[model samples]
Target: MKASHFLFFILLLCICIPASAQEAKMKKIFNGKNLKGWVEPANKACWTVSDGVLLVKNEPAKKGAILWTEKSYQNFIFQADFMMGDGTVDSGIFLRSENDQIQIGISGSLKRDLTGSPYIPKLRYPVEATGVKDLLKPKDWNTLKIKVIGNTYTAYLNGQEVMTYSSADMPPSGPLGIQLHPGNEMSISYRKIMAVAL
Candidate 1:
Protein backbone atom coordinates (compact mmCIF):
# COMPACT_ATOMS: atom_id res chain seq x y z
CA MET A 1 0.00 0.00 0.00
CA LYS A 2 1.13 3.58 -0.71
CA ALA A 3 2.40 5.55 2.32
CA SER A 4 -0.02 8.49 1.78
CA HIS A 5 -2.98 6.11 1.41
CA PHE A 6 -2.06 4.42 4.72
CA LEU A 7 -1.93 7.81 6.52
CA PHE A 8 -5.33 8.85 5.14
CA PHE A 9 -6.86 5.55 6.26
CA ILE A 10 -5.45 5.98 9.77
CA LEU A 11 -6.91 9.51 10.01
CA LEU A 12 -10.31 8.30 8.93
CA LEU A 13 -10.21 5.54 11.56
CA CYS A 14 -9.38 8.07 14.30
CA ILE A 15 -12.47 10.10 13.49
CA CYS A 16 -14.77 7.11 13.21
CA ILE A 17 -13.61 5.44 16.42
CA PRO A 18 -14.97 8.10 18.74
CA ALA A 19 -18.34 8.19 17.00
CA SER A 20 -18.69 4.43 17.32
CA ALA A 21 -17.69 4.55 20.96
CA GLN A 22 -20.35 7.12 21.71
CA GLU A 23 -23.04 5.06 20.06
CA ALA A 24 -22.00 2.07 22.11
CA LYS A 25 -22.35 4.11 25.28
CA MET A 26 -26.06 4.69 24.61
CA LYS A 27 -28.10 2.60 27.04
CA LYS A 28 -31.69 1.98 27.96
CA ILE A 29 -31.56 2.50 31.70
CA PHE A 30 -35.06 1.16 32.32
CA ASN A 31 -35.76 -2.37 31.13
CA GLY A 32 -39.55 -1.68 31.06
CA LYS A 33 -40.31 -5.13 32.44
CA ASN A 34 -38.98 -4.20 35.87
CA LEU A 35 -36.55 -2.03 37.81
CA LYS A 36 -33.57 -4.25 37.24
CA GLY A 37 -31.02 -1.44 36.94
CA TRP A 38 -32.52 0.78 39.61
CA VAL A 39 -32.34 0.87 43.37
CA GLU A 40 -35.92 0.27 44.40
CA PRO A 41 -37.47 2.68 46.84
CA ALA A 42 -38.19 1.68 50.45
CA ASN A 43 -41.88 1.53 49.61
CA LYS A 44 -41.81 -0.80 46.64
CA ALA A 45 -45.58 -0.54 46.30
CA CYS A 46 -45.20 3.07 45.22
CA TRP A 47 -43.45 1.99 42.02
CA THR A 48 -44.66 -0.65 39.65
CA VAL A 49 -44.25 -1.80 36.05
CA SER A 50 -47.17 -2.60 33.82
CA ASP A 51 -47.20 -3.07 30.05
CA GLY A 52 -43.65 -1.66 29.81
CA VAL A 53 -44.49 1.49 31.73
CA LEU A 54 -42.98 2.44 35.08
CA LEU A 55 -45.66 3.92 37.26
CA VAL A 56 -45.35 5.80 40.52
CA LYS A 57 -48.13 6.68 42.89
CA ASN A 58 -48.36 8.10 46.37
CA GLU A 59 -48.46 5.47 49.09
CA PRO A 60 -51.20 5.37 51.69
CA ALA A 61 -48.82 6.88 54.25
CA LYS A 62 -48.33 9.89 51.96
CA LYS A 63 -44.56 9.46 52.33
CA GLY A 64 -42.80 9.94 48.99
CA ALA A 65 -39.90 7.91 47.59
CA ILE A 66 -37.07 8.22 45.12
CA LEU A 67 -36.12 5.46 42.70
CA TRP A 68 -32.40 5.83 42.01
CA THR A 69 -30.13 4.18 39.51
CA GLU A 70 -27.82 1.47 40.71
CA LYS A 71 -24.85 3.10 38.93
CA SER A 72 -23.69 6.71 38.85
CA TYR A 73 -23.33 8.86 35.78
CA GLN A 74 -21.14 11.90 35.29
CA ASN A 75 -21.99 13.61 31.99
CA PHE A 76 -24.74 12.22 29.81
CA ILE A 77 -27.91 12.80 27.83
CA PHE A 78 -31.03 11.52 29.61
CA GLN A 79 -34.42 11.18 28.00
CA ALA A 80 -37.82 9.91 29.14
CA ASP A 81 -41.50 10.18 28.32
CA PHE A 82 -43.86 10.99 31.16
CA MET A 83 -47.64 11.05 31.36
CA MET A 84 -49.35 12.94 34.12
CA GLY A 85 -52.01 11.15 36.08
CA ASP A 86 -54.68 11.92 38.65
CA GLY A 87 -54.55 14.54 41.41
CA THR A 88 -51.84 17.18 41.64
CA VAL A 89 -48.89 15.46 40.00
CA ASP A 90 -45.53 16.31 41.55
CA SER A 91 -42.37 14.54 40.42
CA GLY A 92 -38.85 15.20 39.16
CA ILE A 93 -35.74 13.68 37.68
CA PHE A 94 -32.72 13.91 39.94
CA LEU A 95 -29.66 14.69 37.87
CA ARG A 96 -26.51 13.59 39.64
CA SER A 97 -27.74 13.86 43.19
CA GLU A 98 -30.96 14.55 45.03
CA ASN A 99 -30.00 18.20 45.36
CA ASP A 100 -30.06 18.84 41.58
CA GLN A 101 -33.37 17.88 40.03
CA ILE A 102 -35.37 18.62 36.88
CA GLN A 103 -38.96 19.26 37.76
CA ILE A 104 -41.35 17.09 35.77
CA GLY A 105 -44.69 18.15 37.20
CA ILE A 106 -46.12 20.86 39.44
CA SER A 107 -43.77 22.38 41.99
CA GLY A 108 -44.92 21.61 45.48
CA SER A 109 -43.72 24.88 46.91
CA LEU A 110 -44.49 27.03 43.87
CA LYS A 111 -48.05 25.65 43.69
CA ARG A 112 -47.95 25.50 39.88
CA ASP A 113 -46.57 23.51 37.03
CA LEU A 114 -42.83 24.11 36.80
CA THR A 115 -42.05 21.29 34.41
CA GLY A 116 -38.64 21.41 32.73
CA SER A 117 -37.23 23.69 35.40
CA PRO A 118 -34.40 23.01 37.79
CA TYR A 119 -35.32 22.73 41.45
CA ILE A 120 -32.31 23.20 43.66
CA PRO A 121 -32.82 22.70 47.36
CA LYS A 122 -32.49 25.91 49.44
CA LEU A 123 -31.67 27.84 46.28
CA ARG A 124 -35.15 26.91 45.00
CA TYR A 125 -35.65 27.52 41.30
CA PRO A 126 -32.99 29.73 39.85
CA VAL A 127 -34.65 29.95 36.45
CA GLU A 128 -37.86 28.67 34.93
CA ALA A 129 -38.12 26.93 31.56
CA THR A 130 -39.99 28.72 28.81
CA GLY A 131 -42.44 27.20 26.28
CA VAL A 132 -43.37 24.47 28.72
CA LYS A 133 -46.82 25.88 29.30
CA ASP A 134 -47.63 25.75 25.62
CA LEU A 135 -45.76 22.59 24.68
CA LEU A 136 -46.81 20.39 27.56
CA LYS A 137 -49.73 18.03 26.95
CA PRO A 138 -51.30 17.73 30.35
CA LYS A 139 -53.29 14.61 29.64
CA ASP A 140 -50.98 12.91 27.16
CA TRP A 141 -47.41 11.69 26.99
CA ASN A 142 -44.72 14.36 26.86
CA THR A 143 -41.05 13.81 26.22
CA LEU A 144 -38.43 15.37 28.46
CA LYS A 145 -34.81 15.43 27.39
CA ILE A 146 -32.01 16.66 29.60
CA LYS A 147 -28.37 17.09 28.69
CA VAL A 148 -25.98 17.37 31.64
CA ILE A 149 -22.36 18.26 31.10
CA GLY A 150 -20.05 19.59 33.75
CA ASN A 151 -22.30 21.82 35.85
CA THR A 152 -24.60 22.95 33.07
CA TYR A 153 -28.03 21.53 32.33
CA THR A 154 -30.16 21.99 29.20
CA ALA A 155 -33.74 20.83 29.00
CA TYR A 156 -35.86 20.09 25.95
CA LEU A 157 -39.58 19.56 26.00
CA ASN A 158 -41.13 17.51 23.23
CA GLY A 159 -37.93 17.95 21.17
CA GLN A 160 -37.87 21.76 21.44
CA GLU A 161 -35.04 23.42 23.34
CA VAL A 162 -36.53 25.29 26.27
CA MET A 163 -34.08 26.04 29.05
CA THR A 164 -30.41 26.01 29.96
CA TYR A 165 -28.88 26.79 33.35
CA SER A 166 -25.49 26.50 35.02
CA SER A 167 -25.24 25.34 38.59
CA ALA A 168 -22.35 26.06 40.88
CA ASP A 169 -23.57 23.79 43.67
CA MET A 170 -24.22 20.61 41.69
CA PRO A 171 -22.06 17.63 42.59
CA PRO A 172 -19.51 16.16 40.17
CA SER A 173 -21.34 12.83 39.88
CA GLY A 174 -23.96 10.61 41.49
CA PRO A 175 -26.90 8.33 40.78
CA LEU A 176 -29.96 9.59 38.90
CA GLY A 177 -33.36 9.38 40.60
CA ILE A 178 -37.06 9.50 39.82
CA GLN A 179 -39.05 11.22 42.54
CA LEU A 180 -42.51 10.61 43.96
CA HIS A 181 -43.34 13.61 46.07
CA PRO A 182 -45.28 12.91 49.27
CA GLY A 183 -48.51 14.40 50.62
CA ASN A 184 -50.21 14.19 47.24
CA GLU A 185 -52.60 11.58 45.97
CA MET A 186 -51.17 11.58 42.49
CA SER A 187 -49.72 9.16 39.99
CA ILE A 188 -47.31 9.43 37.03
CA SER A 189 -46.01 7.08 34.39
CA TYR A 190 -42.63 7.01 32.64
CA ARG A 191 -41.38 5.11 29.63
CA LYS A 192 -38.40 4.95 27.28
CA ILE A 193 -35.98 5.94 30.02
CA MET A 194 -32.60 6.15 28.36
CA ALA A 195 -29.17 7.75 28.79
CA VAL A 196 -25.97 8.03 26.82
CA ALA A 197 -22.65 8.87 28.47
CA LEU A 198 -20.64 11.65 26.94
Candidate 2:
Protein backbone atom coordinates (compact mmCIF):
# COMPACT_ATOMS: atom_id res chain seq x y z
CA MET A 1 0.00 0.00 0.00
CA LYS A 2 1.08 3.62 -0.56
CA ALA A 3 2.31 5.65 2.41
CA SER A 4 -0.85 7.80 2.57
CA HIS A 5 -3.13 4.74 2.31
CA PHE A 6 -1.25 2.91 5.08
CA LEU A 7 -1.41 6.01 7.34
CA PHE A 8 -5.18 6.33 6.85
CA PHE A 9 -5.76 2.69 7.69
CA ILE A 10 -3.76 2.95 10.91
CA LEU A 11 -5.69 6.03 12.09
CA LEU A 12 -9.04 4.36 11.48
CA LEU A 13 -7.99 1.29 13.40
CA CYS A 14 -6.86 3.43 16.34
CA ILE A 15 -10.28 5.04 16.69
CA CYS A 16 -12.21 1.80 16.29
CA ILE A 17 -10.20 -0.12 18.87
CA PRO A 18 -11.00 2.26 21.72
CA ALA A 19 -14.70 2.26 20.89
CA SER A 20 -14.78 -1.51 21.19
CA ALA A 21 -13.07 -1.38 24.55
CA GLN A 22 -15.56 1.17 25.83
CA GLU A 23 -18.49 -1.05 25.00
CA ALA A 24 -17.05 -3.89 27.06
CA LYS A 25 -16.69 -1.64 30.07
CA MET A 26 -20.42 -1.20 30.44
CA LYS A 27 -21.79 -4.07 32.53
CA LYS A 28 -24.96 -5.08 34.33
CA ILE A 29 -24.37 -4.43 38.02
CA PHE A 30 -26.62 -7.33 39.00
CA ASN A 31 -26.36 -10.95 37.87
CA GLY A 32 -30.17 -11.30 38.33
CA LYS A 33 -29.53 -14.45 40.37
CA ASN A 34 -27.50 -13.35 43.39
CA LEU A 35 -25.78 -10.43 45.05
CA LYS A 36 -22.28 -11.04 43.80
CA GLY A 37 -21.04 -7.53 42.94
CA TRP A 38 -23.04 -5.40 45.41
CA VAL A 39 -22.41 -4.43 49.02
CA GLU A 40 -24.93 -3.72 51.72
CA PRO A 41 -24.55 -0.45 53.47
CA ALA A 42 -24.17 -0.45 57.26
CA ASN A 43 -27.34 -2.49 57.64
CA LYS A 44 -27.21 -6.03 56.29
CA ALA A 45 -30.19 -7.41 58.14
CA CYS A 46 -32.58 -5.12 56.28
CA TRP A 47 -31.27 -5.89 52.81
CA THR A 48 -31.37 -9.33 51.23
CA VAL A 49 -31.62 -11.15 47.92
CA SER A 50 -35.07 -12.70 47.57
CA ASP A 51 -35.66 -14.72 44.41
CA GLY A 52 -34.04 -12.42 41.82
CA VAL A 53 -34.68 -9.02 43.30
CA LEU A 54 -32.78 -7.26 46.05
CA LEU A 55 -35.25 -6.70 48.87
CA VAL A 56 -34.96 -3.88 51.36
CA LYS A 57 -36.89 -4.64 54.53
CA ASN A 58 -38.48 -2.16 56.86
CA GLU A 59 -35.76 -1.13 59.26
CA PRO A 60 -35.63 2.54 60.05
CA ALA A 61 -32.39 4.41 60.53
CA LYS A 62 -31.21 7.64 62.10
CA LYS A 63 -29.88 9.00 58.83
CA GLY A 64 -29.95 6.66 55.84
CA ALA A 65 -28.72 3.12 55.34
CA ILE A 66 -27.33 2.50 51.88
CA LEU A 67 -26.99 -0.49 49.54
CA TRP A 68 -24.11 0.66 47.32
CA THR A 69 -22.25 -1.04 44.54
CA GLU A 70 -18.72 -2.14 45.30
CA LYS A 71 -17.33 -0.69 42.09
CA SER A 72 -17.23 3.01 41.35
CA TYR A 73 -18.83 4.58 38.28
CA GLN A 74 -18.05 7.79 36.45
CA ASN A 75 -20.27 9.21 33.69
CA PHE A 76 -22.96 6.58 33.24
CA ILE A 77 -26.66 5.78 33.25
CA PHE A 78 -28.01 3.92 36.26
CA GLN A 79 -31.43 2.28 36.22
CA ALA A 80 -33.40 0.22 38.74
CA ASP A 81 -36.92 -0.89 39.61
CA PHE A 82 -37.99 -0.17 43.19
CA MET A 83 -41.14 -0.77 45.23
CA MET A 84 -42.37 1.03 48.32
CA GLY A 85 -45.10 0.42 50.84
CA ASP A 86 -47.06 3.60 51.62
CA GLY A 87 -46.48 7.30 51.26
CA THR A 88 -44.58 6.90 54.54
CA VAL A 89 -41.83 4.78 53.06
CA ASP A 90 -39.08 7.25 52.09
CA SER A 91 -35.84 6.42 50.33
CA GLY A 92 -33.08 7.85 48.11
CA ILE A 93 -30.63 6.83 45.44
CA PHE A 94 -27.10 8.23 45.68
CA LEU A 95 -24.54 8.36 42.90
CA ARG A 96 -21.08 8.54 44.44
CA SER A 97 -17.86 9.67 42.90
CA GLU A 98 -14.40 10.75 44.05
CA ASN A 99 -15.37 14.27 45.12
CA ASP A 100 -19.10 14.74 44.47
CA GLN A 101 -22.23 12.63 45.04
CA ILE A 102 -25.67 13.11 43.50
CA GLN A 103 -28.80 12.07 45.41
CA ILE A 104 -32.13 11.26 43.74
CA GLY A 105 -35.34 9.28 44.37
CA ILE A 106 -38.22 9.85 46.74
CA SER A 107 -37.22 10.43 50.33
CA GLY A 108 -40.66 11.25 51.76
CA SER A 109 -44.12 12.28 50.67
CA LEU A 110 -45.27 15.86 50.81
CA LYS A 111 -46.18 16.61 54.42
CA ARG A 112 -48.13 19.86 54.65
CA ASP A 113 -49.77 19.23 58.02
CA LEU A 114 -46.63 19.83 60.06
CA THR A 115 -46.38 23.50 59.09
CA GLY A 116 -47.72 25.81 61.89
CA SER A 117 -49.06 22.66 63.60
CA PRO A 118 -46.12 21.46 65.66
CA TYR A 119 -42.63 20.96 64.19
CA ILE A 120 -41.14 21.22 60.71
CA PRO A 121 -38.36 19.36 58.94
CA LYS A 122 -36.77 20.11 55.61
CA LEU A 123 -39.82 18.74 53.88
CA ARG A 124 -42.11 20.83 56.02
CA TYR A 125 -39.92 23.91 56.11
CA PRO A 126 -41.46 27.34 55.68
CA VAL A 127 -40.78 27.21 51.97
CA GLU A 128 -41.57 24.33 49.70
CA ALA A 129 -38.65 21.95 49.53
CA THR A 130 -36.54 23.21 46.63
CA GLY A 131 -34.42 20.13 46.04
CA VAL A 132 -37.33 17.87 46.88
CA LYS A 133 -39.27 16.51 43.92
CA ASP A 134 -42.87 15.38 43.70
CA LEU A 135 -44.12 12.30 45.56
CA LEU A 136 -44.08 8.86 43.99
CA LYS A 137 -47.08 6.55 43.79
CA PRO A 138 -47.49 4.81 47.15
CA LYS A 139 -47.51 1.04 47.75
CA ASP A 140 -46.36 0.27 44.26
CA TRP A 141 -43.31 -0.27 42.09
CA ASN A 142 -41.57 2.70 40.47
CA THR A 143 -38.75 2.95 38.01
CA LEU A 144 -35.99 5.47 38.72
CA LYS A 145 -33.57 6.55 36.04
CA ILE A 146 -30.49 8.66 36.67
CA LYS A 147 -28.09 10.01 34.09
CA VAL A 148 -24.84 11.47 35.34
CA ILE A 149 -22.33 13.29 33.20
CA GLY A 150 -19.23 14.60 34.90
CA ASN A 151 -20.58 16.47 37.95
CA THR A 152 -24.08 17.07 36.60
CA TYR A 153 -27.12 14.86 37.18
CA THR A 154 -30.54 14.39 35.57
CA ALA A 155 -33.14 12.11 37.12
CA TYR A 156 -36.40 10.55 35.95
CA LEU A 157 -39.21 8.73 37.70
CA ASN A 158 -41.74 6.56 35.89
CA GLY A 159 -40.68 7.96 32.51
CA GLN A 160 -40.93 11.58 33.64
CA GLU A 161 -38.14 14.09 34.12
CA VAL A 162 -38.09 15.04 37.77
CA MET A 163 -35.10 17.31 38.39
CA THR A 164 -31.54 18.16 37.48
CA TYR A 165 -28.74 19.02 39.86
CA SER A 166 -25.08 19.81 39.40
CA SER A 167 -22.16 20.30 41.72
CA ALA A 168 -18.40 20.63 41.88
CA ASP A 169 -18.28 18.41 44.98
CA MET A 170 -19.77 15.50 43.05
CA PRO A 171 -17.64 12.43 42.78
CA PRO A 172 -16.30 11.86 39.28
CA SER A 173 -16.34 8.13 39.86
CA GLY A 174 -17.84 6.07 42.66
CA PRO A 175 -20.36 3.38 43.54
CA LEU A 176 -24.16 3.70 43.32
CA GLY A 177 -26.18 3.42 46.54
CA ILE A 178 -29.81 3.26 47.64
CA GLN A 179 -30.81 4.96 50.83
CA LEU A 180 -33.02 3.16 53.34
CA HIS A 181 -34.77 6.02 55.06
CA PRO A 182 -34.47 5.86 58.79
CA GLY A 183 -37.33 5.16 61.19
CA ASN A 184 -39.83 3.25 59.10
CA GLU A 185 -40.89 -0.32 58.60
CA MET A 186 -40.42 -0.06 54.90
CA SER A 187 -39.81 -2.84 52.39
CA ILE A 188 -38.37 -2.07 48.95
CA SER A 189 -37.10 -4.34 46.22
CA TYR A 190 -34.70 -3.54 43.33
CA ARG A 191 -34.37 -5.50 40.13
CA LYS A 192 -32.52 -4.78 36.89
CA ILE A 193 -29.78 -2.75 38.52
CA MET A 194 -27.44 -1.67 35.78
CA ALA A 195 -24.97 1.02 34.71
CA VAL A 196 -23.81 1.89 31.24
CA ALA A 197 -20.75 4.10 31.04
CA LEU A 198 -20.77 6.77 28.37
Q: Largest TM-score belongs to which candidate?
A: 1
lDDT of 1 at 28: 92
lDDT: worst 10-residue window of model 2: 113-122
Model 1 per-residue lDDT tens digits across residues 45-138 = 9999998899999988989999999989899889899999988999999998988999988899989999999999979999999989899999
Candidate 1: give the clashing pairs. none
lDDT top scorer:
1
Model 1 spans > 4 angstroms off: 1-25
Lowest-scoring 10 consecutive residues by lDDT in candidate 1?
Answer: 18-27
TM match of model 2 to true structure: 0.65
TM for every model, in the order presented, reads 0.88, 0.65
Residues 7-109, candidate 2: write the lDDT tens digits: 9999999999985666556567887777678785666777778676877766545454777788887888877777764435555566773233223333344
- For candidate 2, what is the total of clashing residue pairs? 11
